[model samples]
Target: MLEKKLHSLSLNQIQIEDMFWKEYMELVRNHVIPYQWEALNDRIKEAEPSYCIQNFRVAAKLEEGSFQGMVFQDSDVYKWLEAVAYSLMWHPDEKLEQTADETIDLIAAAQQPDGYLDTYYIINGLEKRFTNLMDHHELYCLGHMVEAAVAYYKATGKRKFLDVAIAYADCAAEHLGTEEGKIPGYPGHEVAEMALVALYEVTGEERHLNLAKYFIDQRGQEPLFFNEECKKNDNKCFWDDTYMQKQYYQAGKPVREQEKAEGHAVRAVYLYSGMAEVASATEDAELFKVCEKIWDNIVKKQMYVTGAIGATEHGEAFSFDYDLPNDTVYAETCAAIGLIFFARRMFEITKDSKYTDIMERALFNGVISGMSLDGKNFFYVNPLEVNPEACEKDYFKRHVKPVRQKWFGCACCPPNVARLLSSIGGYAFECSEDAIYMNLFVGGQIEAALNGKKNRFHVETQYPWEGTVKIKVENQEDSSFTYAVRIPGWCQNYELTINGVKPEYYVEKGYAILNHVWKNGDEILLKMDMPVTLVEANPRVREDIGKVAVMRGPVVYCLEEIDNQDQLQEIYLEENPVFTETFEKDLLKGVVTLKTQGKRLSEKNWGEETLYRPYRGRTYEKQELTFIPYYAWTNRGIGEMTVWVRI
Candidate 1:
């Protein structure tokens, strides 16, 4: 049987007052957003110049400088604009709005008369445009532009940006497709497929939907459009094919025929997300099953304990199953954000709590870890283990930085984090005609329509720290609908009650289904037992075979050199150790810290001059080890950090 489709509440319809998330939202609005704007204008010192705004200005002929930065530099601006739109929904600022408006006008002015838009081609030679879709990211930039346009229009009901997106999409539809005289190539980075679907939803244009389907259907086909393009361009390949082949671009085979997740981590998830959206829109069960297979392969075999992906730094791509190494993993911040995007689309299709579970896992751990608490610094690569000396001396571990960076020449993670954090309310809840699903325990007030009646809910909780969630129902009329609350996969024991009385409920797809004719002032309380769990990886994972990771609720914990002296690799958690949890308000802007008595190999036996010792049993010294949330690590001074500890 086909499941009823679910839809997420728009950002404006939901307001978050979450103790944990509100602070992040405020950071993005007040600091991150403004900081990024300055960076875009090349105003921030000690940071790599963005040249994003200047590139757009140059393309518009408002300035005479040549194009600079990455091929997708324009995407940073679009992502920031999208974040601004979401922020304005909850916290409106006239100056910020005016700045966004002026930026949009500049972008509009940069558009070609034929509706084509891309600063790279405008500032560079137009004749060379679309010739290198395999590397140049023109379509990728278009996708982010459409997404930002949709978000801006939805937030403010302004059509200026929407019209710009419509024109560019029309231009794409005209130039690239299966139609006669049109190119048959798709985005090397796969966001356009899903962005076009979003544009279709707003514009009610069949061409947009058809274009999206065309992109998905055309990928990995015979003759490999990318190879043909390369051939046409005199066999000139911009990026080396050593690590990134057709498979690295996910164009080796038809997407449905591809079984496992492969290629650049960000591109793979973006493509999978697009496939999931198209599958849902078309009701293609076969395609959705493919999404299921790839998703399982990711979370089950290739993912980190902190919900991070991309096991290897070679290509920033997935390696074989059970190949999750700690110190050398890539786990790019953008990949985690892309994973959340994929998870949300899947949950909207099936209304399953399993999808939401992974979403929350990535949200609280991997995604937020991309940015520092102050929101001024960012991490492009999130590693489970880091050693400053190794990072400096070891070529293989060079990508694993012990501290966050202020900015990057290829600055994609910061604005991506900003947009996701700003629109997080959309991921918190989804609604259908007769049911409402609370996907995450984000404390907020959501106004959604249920059975043709407006229903308001105030969700209150201290999540990740405490698992008790109290949802107060407010409605003008009595509503008979199913309130599906997600019971996290990590939670084993939980209690659910309605207005102080236990209610009849059943579990399906990891959600506790509460069916009732709800009334105003009624309260639903869910208390999930939060215990500091010791999680062991599958034995097949060689690196983590004898190690265990610490987690409480959805937050993964790690030991930092600041808390537990250096040489984190030498520490071992005692067998059957007892952990004590304390809330430290002054630490990392407040977090729950875990402490346990553990053992460390005694180094006194070996003298500084002794390079080798006789084969004897190692001596151990008992020490108290403290663990902070994985996301909170490195916020203090730089040092060694590891998530998995020897047992």
Candidate 2:
């Protein structure tokens, strides 16, 4: 039934396929794409490395023994390139993919006869095979490349990148596996497994899938991890922290028992999501249940009000459940990106609202929260609250302070957002040809062939700000189709009209179905009320109780100390305060400011009394404060900022 009108495509399709990936691709076409193409052309011109080994026909051979001192940073670049390439696939940027094709060939040529591929090993030095996990990020790098290649192949029906990915995956299958004579396949970090599965989709080659499966299956098996301390000589060790030093690169417990998300948050979620996809593809019910368990535990207790996950600064890792302390929360940008991946997979697995709910929340508030509104600067850590004044006091703790930053060393969000946006159309709808569901409201045009007929839809809306969606539908011929639209959990009323006439589909649960005969130029208008909604985290999240966060149409709003008289903690938005906002077109494009009366608690009272009473009567005069979108904070010269404030 989903095949008829709307597919789950509108879901991720708007964000990943349309908005994110497409924007990123354009960004590339504008800046990075040209640079990459030039770089590839240069490489082809120079014939890098000098014929170390003969590779695929499309590839240029690398010279023998040129890159000896490099710390495998070159290896990681391939992954980024691969991501770039695949991002070009569904988004269809030929020039970039062609450059990627050349790079893929270069990678293939670097491979050893037995299937090993590493320029350092084959060209420059020797025998550094899985010898350094902590510093290398080798497997993690390859995994991304493989994934990018596979995605590119699937999207474009092209195999240039795929061949290189297969060759590398084949090499891993040969040597780095759990079976005897094979090295156990667990990345020092855990992304390659997922990447392999993504790679496997193109090959449909069982070995690649099995190799990916083996990495996941072999996790927590026996040797938690192959300790490379001796190899790093203990001094200048990759994982310097003693606690991290003692950790098992791969855990030894059954995957289900591996409940608390361990390791780096990005690695953990990427690995888990890959495992979920494998489970679905393989029909492994146990893995699916395990995924659900982990998902439930995360959203219920660990995720931030912004839908950001991961809570500790130690490894940018997950802390205990419900231990989401806002000031100290290390909600990494990559973790939120990973959450999107995990949540989307969960959406496909169960077709449930909960997963998409998190997906939507993260996509708008947390994930995009990582990127600046202008599409450049990104925040590596998206903390909920910050006392900019306190940051001067506790310097280290100040890292948790929420602010928009230029870029991170491990800049994953930019490309991740890019690829997600480019492929967003796919997320909007999914179908086997019977029914369609509108998951997200983003203004866009789509043309899809349905049931031997061509159907097109042009959705016009100012969504994520206003809740109105008007869809103009066109078909080759008059026909009957069923369209399902999601009724948000937050909205009090859902209204729909067909051909300017008021109509209700008899909503149940959260899905409203409109089944009807359609004609060319027919219109469907749906409006969801967008009132300023105050949300509170569950009691388990002790950091959020007694504090309220305001969200208007997916964008979370916050109050900066700049806009308030006292520090953020001492201020509160008066109940039933008159609020007014206007879009300031100049000098910031668009500005949404909220003016509300707030009474600041007296800090002087505490200073005067030697004996401190924890509770005191509300002091200080009521002050008017202007609240802006949380994404807009810190631009006004780093002052105390509060995302969630006392009611």
Candidate 3:
């Protein structure tokens, strides 16, 4: 219901030189990006065979071999290029840029006449194209292609890759949609919608925007396009009455009619994010309302405490409302990254603080949990609770891995994390003609244009661990603008001072706004009180009754078996537990570990190890407990981890 529109800063405009995020970004550039490139080329002998580059060569007729990876193997190359593009934006490396350019050349060679570029279809057969649109991922690959092309153009102002992407998009426009002699089809996996929007933003092509809008509109119509396409090709109906449902692809009904979060979590969020973009561009109030309703459904009822979206491991989809199980959870890393995409789009349309809050929450905890400190290992499924034996022995908990793996054949999360972290500066702040919104309080420098004049500002902070932030305006003395600092949803008490003088200010939608004439060396200091608070889920969430998760600032803290004793379930919170915080400079690459007093319940005091035993009074022994950031849990040889403990 909010009215203000958002305009995110350009990737080059905001530079992150932060103590925390800069390290992660460097890790992506130095380790993850190069590592993923090696993986795509099938050079990593220890990792799974991706066959990404080989497939391109086969499709291009430069080599003779069969495609050996997933139908979407081509996306791996595209995602890596996108990550490299974002990486080169601020940390320009000629070697990385050359590598990406060469990869793009291989991709360009793989394109078929009339501008079709999917390696699966190019090598497999163009006759097979669009026939299996339900699962072939043709549009999905094109989506990544367009996204990478846009980033590359923005990063290096290179038109070669963008030209390739536009050619393919034009082909899509000619083939798909509801026009006469055109097939009415949409993507099995989304991303094309938003990617097309990005293309339109760069090229100012009305067809690209219209094509994206057409895809959104044609989906889930009376005759579902997916069903019709499947029936035409003798493929089984995607919405089989017996097993899989159309909701699995978020195509059960028209997007506006679909009120609840359903289907594959990543697909659903990507599709919704695209819908938000189209709604924003078209200024469609009804479509905007759909976004708001769906956002409410996801964030209010379905989202996990750690900001992960999906609930069930089956199909990696959401379960029933308030059915957020902690132990058997499938909070896919890709889905959390998709949530950030969705939230950012929602924020662009409504300029709501709630959307930014979710983005920050997911970034600091669930999303980053996908990557390890070393930046080589990654988790595809980020579960809230971990039990090593249960993860190994229990079939229901099979998707939850106790430790990050070296690689996967799919290889989605590692590169997805890399792309997000590399381009993270775009998410930190947004600016208008005369106002600046500090979205995330990370140490950075922003160079932007306001009122036809260039302005610069420098921010210094030890955020997420320490609560104090100092920002200095570096504009000319006569320049004036409104500065807005986001007061995080978790913060309860804070103080702000300008030029060392406290001033009365008004908070609008979680942002403390100060309108002032900026001058060089004008300093603003913000102090937020950091306290260990207990967070409880809504009463509707049956899994988290009479339990609390420890939180300080934006980070969610968890108890791991490495710190606590074995048998994690026996741990209980003390009635009036006192928590003390200390900075461990050498632990987990320097984090603030929280220490508290708790009790370990005596499991042996029970009468017997029976399923149904009447509980007598149980004995408890005091134990000192240590909690680390949830994102840093499995870095030290994972065993057991729990966020919500007995209170």
Candidate 4:
């Protein structure tokens, strides 16, 4: 039997002061949140209009305008509000809280008498609501709304937003399910399944839990509900393409029978996340096994070196096994974020460090790459390789942006980044009945009760750049509990000592288990060797067969056109190259850059117009290649960037 499931430390319980994460948290608090608020209200000049706020007003009949933006645009505001809720937990601001409250009030006003919300249906026509469950994202919007409401209520102790969420949930419960007169349909886009689970956790509503389960159980069942609905609706879909097929929605087969991770990348992970959560809550071992199988498939075969997924741009989705492309990849930012969500929940259920490893990988590399250092511009597609000319000229690589844009018309990735970064404290720590799991090496102060005894800890570290973590325990009463510190998968050499002496420790699934009676001022030190590593992909990955990716700790390194000359593809690393680490405080918001001696395939002997130049035994000149953290690329003007270089 599984032990009691672990619970993440609440956002209020952990205060992040990490030199690495604090910058991101502060960026979300100060710049990203404010900028998104303006964008949502359609106030950002020279950018695409959001009209999210105006849609709510129009739905409430407080203003006269048709619904604008994507049908799921409401989620952008909810995601921003969720980020604000997390930010307010650590950085209190009266003005921001007031704005959020006002926004919640507007949301409440837009809700119908039947407790139905969603400006697209409310403003368009209430009669047509739920008519196209396979296309319209009504359920998807409600999911984000509930998530925001839960976060806000936790932050402010305000029930207004929570009440709205409960009411809308009740409305959904009344309409969707297996009972007579119910729609018996799930979201075309996922997240509702997980959001309903969140609502169930907060409200203790069995129906919410059941609704989430029903969505999961009903998905990919025989005589697919999506097909039936499509037939009923005369085959009209919001996104009419090959993506409208059942496989793209991950509804081609029953959830339990599905093996490989497939379909839209975001939807696949979002569904898997919900499955993990519901399985944990209900102790469904079968469902948990399914999650494990898919997780293995994704991390082993499908994922990129930077923890990115969705190998193809066609559906913004996963391609076949071992088909992870480099340039024409559509590794959306939200897909990586969703993978983190799944990884965290899996860790919570199983107390396994592998889950946290992937979670850390995605958090440090793929997720952060979505937002700029200043937190203004955003990238929807986080490609591992980029060439300006190819991105412009090659039709297949059109989605690959050489530079992060100020805003996007779709605009989901920015606010998603905001919420994830703001609430990062929750991801860093987890508490069980008899153990405290330190998942991510983030510098912070955390307070949690283990085995009914309160304990406070101070963690200090400069991770990703340097790996020396010092943890100090403070508690009034001497407590005996296991403190599980993760030994990151990438760290081959590490030393852990308690109070200046190495303790008797046991390794369990990648975590160094230190079971001891804790006391005040008992300090623990962890030193992980941060050596630059050259990583080569599996031979199956043809794109990276003879190439190497530079990495230090969890940060993947990339070569940009600014640091090296253009034609980044011409760069090559010698076998067993040596790298020197340099901390440049002035560059890309104080990052540790790696300098290495490598060879660049010289074009000096070739003509300027030579497109098909034969490699005459590969003439090369030795050059010092500069490698910055992959997340920091594109911050300094658009240039050629590649994570993999030929060796």
Q: Which lDDT tens digits does candidate 3 get at residues 1-647? A: 33336577887887888789998999999999988888887788778888999999998889898878899888888889999999998888999899899999998998877998888877777888888778888899999999999999999998999999999999998898777998888898999999999999999999999999998988899798877877788888534772448888888788889888898899999999998889888877888788889899999999998899899887789888999999999999999999999998887665568889999999999899999999988899998888999999999998899999888988878878999999888888887788888888889899878767788899999888899999988876457778888888988898899999997688888788898877889899999999999999998899899889999999999999999978888899986678999989799998999998899987664556566666677888889999999999889886999999998
Candidate 4 total steric clashes: 0
Q: What are the candidates' C-alpha RMSDs? A: 1.3, 5.6, 1.7, 1.5
TM-score list, all predictions: 0.98, 0.83, 0.97, 0.98
lDDT of 2 by residue, 487-508 (tens): 7766787578999997657553
lDDT of 4 by residue, 1-647 (tens): 43236887888899999878999999889899999999998888888999899999999999898989999999999999999999988778999999999999999999999899989999889988888877688888988999999999999999999999889888988998778999878888899888988888898989889989998999988788887888887766434466436778888888999888988999899999999988877888998899999999999999999999999987888878889898998999999999999999888877888999999999989999999999989999999999898999999889999999889889999999999999998889988878889999999889998888899999998887889999999888899999999999999999999999999999999999999999999999999999999898999999998899999999999999998998888889989898899988899889999998999887787887888855577688999999999999999898899999999
Better of 1 and 2 by TM-score: 1
The candidate that achieves the highest lDDT relative to the unseen native structure: 1
Better of 1 and 4 by TM-score: 1
- Candidate 2 TM-score to native: 0.83
For model 3, the superposed segments whose C-alpha errors exceed 4 Å read 1-4, 237-244, 605-614
The top-ranked prediction according to TM-score is: 1
lDDT of 1 by residue, 1-647 (tens): 23437887887788899889999999999999999999999999899999999999999999899999999999999999999999998778899999999999999999998888999999998888888888889899999999999999988899999999899989888889887999999998889999999998898888998999899989999989998998898656544456557888899889889889988899999999989888887788898899999999999998888888998888889878889999999999999999999999888887788788999999998999999999999999999999899999999999888899999999999999999999888888888899988888889899988888899999999887999999999888788899999999999999999999999999999999999999999999999999999999999999998899999999999999988899988999999999999999898999999999999988987889999978798889999999999998899888999999999
Q: What ordering of candidates by TM-score runs from best to worst?
A: 1, 4, 3, 2
